[model samples]
Target: MPTLLTRQRWQLLTCLALLLALAAGIGLRAPTPPDEPRFVLAARAMVETGQWLLPHRGSELYAEKPPVFMWIQAATYQVIGNWNLAFLLPSLLAGLATLWLSWDLARRLWNRRIAWWAMLALASCLQFGLMAKRAQIDMVLVALTTLSLWALLRHLLERPNTRLLWVAGFAAGLGTVTKGVGFLPLLVLLPWALWRWKVQLRPGAALPRARSLLWLIPAFLLGTAVWLGPLGIALLNDPSPELQGYARELLFKQTGTRYANAWHHVQPAWYYLQVIATLWLPGSLLLPALLPGWWRRLRRGDSRYWLLLGWALLVLLFFTASPGKREVYIFPMLPALCVAAAPLLPGLLRRPGPRWLLLAYVLVLGAAALGIGAQLLGDGAWAHAQLARRGMPETLLPVLGAWLLGFGIVVLLLAAWLRQRRAGMLAVLTAVLLWNLHGWGLMPALGPYSSSSALMQQVGERIGPSAELGALAWREQNLLQADRPVTDFGFKRPWDEQWHDAGPWLAQAPHNRWLLVLEQAISPCVDRAQAVMIGSANRNRWWLVPGTAWNAACHAELSKDAAAGVDDGD
Candidate 1:
């Protein structure tokens, strides 16, 4: 086996390179739809409008989540003025924290070699690496959850550090604001309860100190108060129905309505079980092969395995049991999974069959990349037709070409590692670095239709950046794309053949000149002769309406609000 110092410099260099790549393109891609725009817009609102306590999406109260993640993003954006950097820093840092937590946990459970191997294995995890750079809640949540576990596990191993027990709960509490699932750390108590009920710890069993659980509550509540206190003061001082409703939506509805009766991303109970294969990647392949080894460890009375496995399994079961499932929901458990699985890697890789198998697995992965490139950049009419059927853009050809080259190089690198079997772990880390490049570099082209950032910049230039804009409906991407504040003209219904209906909603404005941006497809059917055809981006068609007649009745209400000294709610 390679000692702790074997190829240490190369390992450090590769890990550092991967970190740079992971943190490379925070602001590169347009903020994606469904979740990102809302989060991005909320952070932008906080920075621009100074509503740090309350997060607003466009002109409406956004309480889908608490403001911890948004607060960090907003703080970053405020200093640097780069939206991508602001939006993505939390995930990147959280990913780093999770990796360190994994390394420490491995070192505690086994040794330094296992700890180093664990960190590398974790960095290469397909899901963990992706979330690390995304403008999403999962990565932060995972980090906090992992940190909490690591702290508590440290306390268990070294009873002198009782302070870590409280730290665990506090991280969980902060996690709660990051996402509803922030309370995952509190779940650690379940296993302790189980152990207490069934098994008696020997004198030096390194179990949890009994009194430590008491300190966790205050720390958790204190973490929550960071957001809750400010939010309360803001809402209490200036009460509004939207703000009130948002509070309920976040605290309860997001948990209850979204949990029991989720409106979006409702997947099967077995959904996570199916996605686990993709999430763990090469490590996942070794999982099945390592089962006997894991079972042996468990049987040998090493209670640490039980603790780690129990924590990960409980998280998996908790999310899987929920009706609302996303692939990302299971990500928090991955760090623990890596640590738990780290011990088996040294044994498996020392064998010839496992090394050859890993090589073959990577070979298949490379061939898959080549095939994707062929379909994307090649003159395969059948592939073009297939992609066209799925509504992909022809512009993706070049993007795919770049990804193909990157993957091809990674394949060659993996082959070299295969030839030099001692560098097996290097191959995996390098593969992850390549994967990061593909995801971060080529993401813009992957989903062309969703984000309108590039197109919206052009619109902003033509209409003047300060001009306030509004969307006809609730496609929230406009808020992120627009340079100015975008009022949501909550649509009565989507624009259709009778598209004139959207005119009133689209035309309503606090600003005099109304720049109604619509899909190019809708413009042809919507009679644009009366409006000035100002500009168009790839697929977004823009028109300027002179009269502020969008939603005329809303205009009457606005007049009343002005007379009553009531500023409009956004």
Candidate 2:
């Protein structure tokens, strides 16, 4: 291993390079759908109104998520006076912070080589790398959760300090405010605490005093109250039944209803198994080979390995059991996965053998890259058509060729470097470099298709600043991109009965109003004209302009589509 990569010398430079790559071009493009636009627009609304407690997309209350992440984004926007970097800066900073904390944790638990390798495993991952660069809640939540766990685990390993425990609790509470899964570290702590209490209650077993919980408990409550208190007061002062309903929904329904009986993105228990195997790709491939080593360590009466495994399983199984699932939901456990996997690399690359593990990894990746590159070169339009089917932009087959070629070169270098044990780490470094290049170079090409900004701008030019804009079956990005007051004509959530009463209000709105909509419905829609197909991203096509009328044809067509479950696809 290079001593230069260790904290004693070149480590800071390496970290800076990594951070630069992660933060670079974060502001270069507008956000994409589903999560980013919604959160960013809500933050924009928050900044506009200075109402930090209740979030809004436009005039409607946005109850999908709590406001900790939004608050950071809004503050960033306030300071920068623009939404460009502000929307994604939180995730970037959080991800870099995660990398640093992960390095320190690995250094404490193991050696310098293991620490560097652990951080590389995380930073190089397909899942973690992408999430860190995007404007998403998962990265922030993962960062806070990891920090809380790190503090608590430090106390668990050696120093039995009440202050560390308190910090751990406070961080965990903030994590909760960040996302619903924020307090999961406390689950790991609870078992450890009970085990400690059990052992401490007996005769002295190399330790006599039980850990203090006095400050830890109170700190956690206060951290939660940082947001909850304001939420309650905001609801109390408003006296609106809708706000009260939002309060109840945020507290209870978003937890139980969204988890046990999720309204969207439901998946089977085994979904994460596939996601972890792929998205954590090439890194997680060693899990099968690494398990026996962990088992042996446990058999030798070393509890650390099992503790890490338990923490990982706690995250994995919890999300696995939930009816709602996303690939990013498994991210909070990536730290443990990286740390636990770090030690196996040294043995897996041992020189006494033919280095089968390294060879397999290189060959698999190299071949995969070659296959993609070949396919793109031979059938460029075929790939383009495939992306078109998914409502994605052109694959930029030429750029993909370059990306794959570069990846292949790195894989070849990885194969060559396997002659030396220290060079084994190059595989991970190359992966990270390839991902950074892809993000900085190729991914931005899709921005036109991914963002609604251009369409919004075009419409803004036509309608000017005074006109009211609305969207039916539209995304939040349209609202964020619009300069005028925008209305969400789509039903945000099934519980949002506000849409049920939308007909009269929508019909009564100003005559100069224009609504943007998806192209699939305009055939049956009312008075549709000059409806330009603007762009496509993630299986949806957005249009520049679509007209609406308070006629039976429009209502009948909408009602029929609603009955036919168009909302399910939209």
Candidate 3:
């Protein structure tokens, strides 16, 4: 009884739901990364104090990223006390928004088949998929970038709606708040390039005339005003100005000097080439072929093609110039790559002869999987050594092996499906979704981190809900996510285990029993206590309670350290 349109709509909906379900399932239970704990700390600070303009770490105003993720995470934390859930949910939702936007963009430029493949391909990617699971700003960056592209394309090809342009600008502003001001300038180039290309050919088909430049004014103000507006007002109103004294330290010193002057870590330019190649599995290589094809169409007045192309290029350029490079920095480009590649998939599938390029990509993916599996399996001439000393059971080994086998099977299946031109939509979608679920979803969960999860759960029970906990010398945020109030005891560099300054707070804590989650090699201050083996006892005990006789020397050492001035107050 369903019409063809209704069927197609239902199919699209089903695919979307499957993608969301996979993302949510994988993300919800996954361990929070080290960086996530920092975000939670910031968010907790935000909620406790109603200063949306300034990002804080406890009482100190922390100058890292703008307050976007902190605000959202804090808001989410208000509903759910679980900081991991708060951080994970917003990013996960952002990823879902990206998928939906990619599908809609692809559908407009190409066919439904390509749209389905594009969305699935994007959702399946290891890097993007993992980002969705992690509580970070990268997912939000991608979502904003994707939405801006969608709006820019709509403006260029369809009607030049003022609302869309303004919205795009606002999204870019929001993205700036989320991350830094990386891709904000690309707004001008996107629609401008489209208009220029159209103008060179014929006047009638061109984008909104030169008068449309008026939109940029409101766009800039609105985009920046969301966060900076409040910041400016706060700075102006301060009687005892904290920002005024450190004006140089806050702005140019941190952003410009940190990257350009090489005050931080630097890698070779070729670093990102390697990052993009393997971070997202085998499909990442497809970008080289996809870029040129998309460019040709874009130059020929295919609005979406060029808009995405511009956005993707801008992201790459932004990160390439940035000295503060990390694997996740290029995340904004993934959705654009998906959009660029999707249009070509149907044609590639319909081709008679087997595409060598496609096979090559699959083989590369398989090789990457094999290499990773080798590293994980541990040291040996054949098997190689990895986390072997952790004494992980042999039963867990097959999880990686099974993943490799599945990757191989998917390559063959996709190749066969492409050759026969059958299950074109369903096959690609299934392959991408499955790959994402396994590679990004299962892989992060099944590693040493999973063992840590077990440890945290046991520790959480012993520590109780109200016990005051502190990370003595641990970097694992997952342990912090356990339902307990945990603080850092300043075990990190420059401030080594400052328990003296932290002593007053420890004494003031409601619970007498202190849980010390120490790193593998380091030993906590000795006394009476039983440790619940979270992952492995020797490996690093979880749910560990320290004795009444805490080490006085350790506290003295921490107190004398110059950097430990903030104490447990920090």
- Candidate 1 per-residue lDDT, tens place, 183-294, comes to 8867766765665566666776655557766788898888778778777886888788877887887888877778778767789888987788877776776777777887
CA-lDDT, candidates in order: 0.69, 0.71, 0.61
Error of 2 at 88 (Å): 1.6
Model 2 local distance difference test score: 0.71
Per-residue accuracy of model 2 over 361-451 as CA lDDT, tens digit each: 6667777886777776676667778667655534467677767767776676767766445435655665666656656655575565567
Model 1, which residues run further than 4 Å from truth? 1-7, 200-203, 206-208, 234-239, 382-396, 416-423, 444-450, 458-468, 491-512, 515-570
Misplaced by over 4 Å in model 3 are: 1-10, 13-17, 24-30, 44-61, 79-85, 107-121, 185-199, 239-254, 280-282, 291-306, 352-469, 473-479, 487-493, 497-570
Positional deviation of 207 in candidate 1, in angstroms? 4.0
Identify the candidate with maximal lDDT.
2
Looking at model 3, which ten-residue stretch has the lowest summed lDDT?
Answer: 561-570
What's the CA error at residue 433 for candidate 1, in Å?
A: 3.6
Q: Per-residue CA lDDT of candidate 3, range 1-570, in tens?
A: 469889888776867665655454543454444466667767776776776667655335666566778788889878877754676778778888998998987887777767877887786566876677677778888788778767766665666788877767777766765676534544547555654656454455656665664685678568777777876777778745667643445556655776576455466776788888888654564566556667678767655665666667766776688666778877777877777787786665565432454455555555666565554454333332233344344555556665665565665566555544453443344445454656454556453354255556656676666666655445444443456655655433233434443444454542465645443322344333444444542243443544343544443342243433332211
Between candidates 1 and 3, name the one with more favorable lDDT. 1
RMSD (CA, angstroms), candidate 1 = 5.9
Clashing pairs in 3: 378-384, 378-385, 378-386, 379-384, 379-385, 380-384, 455-534
